[model samples]
Target: MLSSGVLAGSASVQGPQGEVAQFEYSGSMLRINAAQNDGYALLRDGHFYTVGYNNGQPMVFDAGAMLKGFGDMAPQAIHGDLGAEIASLKDTGENEVVAGIQGDVYEVQFIDDSGAQRSESLVLSTDKRAQELRDALFQMMNFAESMTPGQEKAKAQSQDIRARLSSLNAGILRYGSEVTVTEISGEPVAAQRFELPAQPLDLQGLGKLFGQ
Candidate 1:
């Protein structure tokens, strides 16, 4: 078992395409430094903070109204044939071992908005230690949602994930090109690290920074 101080690690994308795509990133591709609130991000080039520390109301500020654009880059599925979507999923009941940890693997077989069928693989932790880490991360995630401006809808989706996790005896540790948490440590982090960046650069600066 690990302490609840701070779980920090990085996971470069794996899989064939993932390896090729991971080349562009430098440091950690994602971080969970936020402890009690949702992290913030610019909406493409929009003038508001679409994703941030919302608290059940319109978190409007001088920048702009942080209207929810689906919480930036959330991985769970959303509207548009949610019923049909769930019906299309296929659980291969396949399991794989990675780095001495056992996990269940599954794939999604769904027709995209462009009418193209896409299949994606995800691994769920079955290891006891990994399960504890998954719970900790889930706690942090719920903290973010609890701050949402009227999080009823978002909370429901979050609950769906939680329910599926236990019911299925698994929780997602990685998804697509976005999230992929592997190791967890108990390093202490300053409270200030959980807050938003003092000065977030615009999308243009980000493009240049990443050399895109």
Candidate 2:
């Protein structure tokens, strides 16, 4: 059930029970090509990429949610969260966690799971790439405000500035080797669809329930 002007893509995952897992799109159709056998899916639109992987039973992980989990950081939905100033790096608490200060660079710490210990700092940048990106976006917004002046020259300049800002930025930063980028058109994409059909319940059958 994909919409027009969109594509459908899918990926596979190896399950513990040796069952075949399929991830299908129910909204926009994604075209997948030149795939490897490493259970990875990467979709690209120009320089931007959206990636996801199949877990099992056609359950494809949401890219945004997976990004948050892998980065161990939340998206800047609110105004004052650390995400507003610095991007979150997915650390999984297995090795590190990211901390940020507004208008400054971000740092990572190798924190223990119990939150009782921390290792040395790992600074990502010095000039604050997050804040720089924010500023660039705001600059484009300001340029767009000029369109209300009713001046032809100002309007042209505003359009030029907006395009420059957009082209200058390549979208969100990425981390980790397992992450994949997907190509998606500008539209309301579905989160992901999945179902678990009913099957017989018994010990031996249950052992093979996953197709063992």
lDDT of 1: 0.41
Deviating ranges (above 4 Å) for candidate 1: 1-90, 108-119, 184-212
Clashes of each: 6, 16
How do the residues 79-120 of candidate 2 rate in per-residue lDDT, one tens digit apiece?
111112122233232332222221212232332224453322
Q: After superposition, how far is residue 204 of candidate 1 from its true place, in Å?
A: 26
Best by TM-score: 1
Clashing pairs in 1: 54-147, 55-147, 56-148, 56-149, 56-150, 57-149
The parts of candidate 2 lying over 4 Å away from their true place are 1-107, 113-173, 178-180, 184-192, 199-212
